[model samples]
Target: MQRYFVAPEQFRGGAVTITGEDAHHALRVMRMKPGDKIIVSDGESRTVLASVTELIPQAMKADILEKLPQDSEPAWSVSIAQGLPKGDKMELVIQKGTEIGAAEFLPFESERIVVQYDAKKESKRLERWGKIAKEAAEQSHRHRIPAIGPVRSWKELLATIPDYDLAVFCYEREGDAAQGVGIGAALRKFREGKLLSLEEGRTPSVLIIVGPEGGFTDREAAEADAAGAVVAGLGKRILRTETAGIVGLTCVLYEAGEMGGE
Candidate 1:
């Protein structure tokens, strides 16, 4: 069944009111009408099967059939903190990352990043990225859309490191045998409960940080290491900036047994 994410307020008295782009999609794109079945999510883990009761260009209403189980989300909430790369690679990162169950995306500026940060264009860029995340979430049957954080500077990004239960820095330097622990080992430790957060019963949150094209500078890497991040390597072979986050996330979910059948 086709699924759409709507605001919490849209659900009232057992009926969901779909508005804006989703309404247009239901009315025009999907050609949904009364009696058509669709799934609706409030994006807060509340998902339901609904029967369309009304349709218009600006709005669509559906009567709730039954609440659906929220099983699509991963046990570990992984957020990707990507260093802004050149060209449209960010879009690719956001789209694929969302599909792979990334809970959030954080695009940040780094030392070797080539793309100049533009405050004027940030809003439009965020809007487009958000749209991409939303579409990817709906297609992937995710109950909640992945959040896209506003682009941050190097210092600003480091400041948020404490927010996660565990933060893994995808440093190329760690690829050397003599360097830091491997990504698999770090995640295994997390999976084994060695890295559990102080909060009991809370879903473990992980932050995976991937550097841009030229990768992180030594000074920057040091800063991240000092900021309580677990420095880990993807593998001996190098990966593009956009590829690192997805691979790291996959490793995390796989380690958590989220990629396997229940």
Candidate 2:
């Protein structure tokens, strides 16, 4: 069944009001009629089965039929902090990141960032990235759309590092996985070191930081290490700015056993 996301306000008294581009898609593109069943989610990690009841002017109404059981979200929450990469690579990052279970994306300006976002273009870019995340989440059957954070400076991201349970910065200088410094080894060390004190069912929150095409400077790596990030390598091969986040996230989810169903 096709799915549409609605706001809490749009869901009233067991009926969901689909509006804007989503409604337009259902109305014009899909040619959906009354009695067509579709999945509707509140974007709060919950989905429901609903049937179209009426098509009003510029809006489509659906009656909630049944709330379906869903567990698409990963066991742990992950946020990607990516340094500004040139061109539309950030869009690809946002789109694919959503599908793979990143909870949020933060774009930051690093010393090596070649791309610059002007004050006027910031809002427009943010809006477009948000739309990409929304569509990707819908297609991936994600319960919630990953949030698109504003582009910030390196200092801002570093300042937020202490907030997460685990924060890893992908550094080529860290070398290959055999050296016991890759994300996999780091995560294993973390779990084994803390299993005694850590409680079960307490999902860990993670932050993975990836730099741009040019990568981070030596000084930035030093700063990140000081800021409490585990400076780790992905593998022997260096990945592109767009590729690092997805690979890093996959490694993280896999390490957390989030790649499998409970």
Candidate 3:
């Protein structure tokens, strides 16, 4: 069944009202008619088996047949703090990151980042990124769409580090060779300490910051480390700015038991 994400308020009593782009997708793209079945998610980990009831002009209304138990969301929430990269790479990061179970995305400016959004078109780009996340969520059967934060500066990004239980500053530095333990060790720390760090029966949120094309400068990485982020590397091999987020996130989710039975 085709899946769509909708706001909770869209479910007005008897049915879910699909609007905007999704409405066009169903009415024109999918050519869906009354009695067609689909899965509608509330964007908050709740979903339902719904059947089309009324085609309200450009919109489509569907009556929820059965409330489904959402099992797609991971137990641990991961927030990816990605350094701004050039061109459409951010779009790729947002799209693939959503599918990989990122709870949210934060784009920041690092010393070596090469891209900058113009003042006139920043909102438009943010909107587009958010849309990509939503579509990817639907396609991947995710419980919720990942929230995309506005592009922030280096200092601004560092200030938000305390909000997470674990903040990994993904650096291609000395790695495990000369620096501290690699990202693998950092993930291990969380795995072994997850039970001890639980608050109100919920796993703590994690933040992983990936540098852009040129990677993080030594001074910048030091600042992040001083700000409470664990500076770690993916492995001995260096990854591009766009590739690091997903790689780091997969490792985090995998180690945290979000990718399988724990």
CA lDDT, every prediction? Answer: 0.90, 0.88, 0.87
RMSD of each: 1.8, 1.8, 1.7
Better by lDDT, candidate 3 or 2 = 2
What C-alpha lDDT, on a 0 to 100 scale, does residue 256 get in candidate 1?
Answer: 74
Q: Estimate each model's TM-score.
A: 0.95, 0.95, 0.95
Over 7-52, each residue of candidate 3 has an lDDT whose tens digit, in order, gives 8899877689999888998988888999999999888856999999
Residue 128 in model 3: shift from native, Å?
0.6
State the displacement of the C-alpha of residue 199, model 2, in Å, after optimal TM-score superposition.
5.1
Clashing pairs for model 1 are: none
Q: Check candidate 3 and list the clashing pairs.
A: none
| lDDT (tens digit, per residue) of candidate 2 on 202-238 | 7678899999999999899999999999999988888
Ranking by lDDT: 1, 2, 3
lDDT of 3 at 32: 91
Candidate 2's TM-score reads 0.95
Which segments of candidate 2 are over 4 A away from where they belong?
Answer: 176-180, 195-201, 260-262
Off by over 4 Å in 1: 177-179, 196-199
lDDT of 3 at 196: 77
TM-score of 1: 0.95
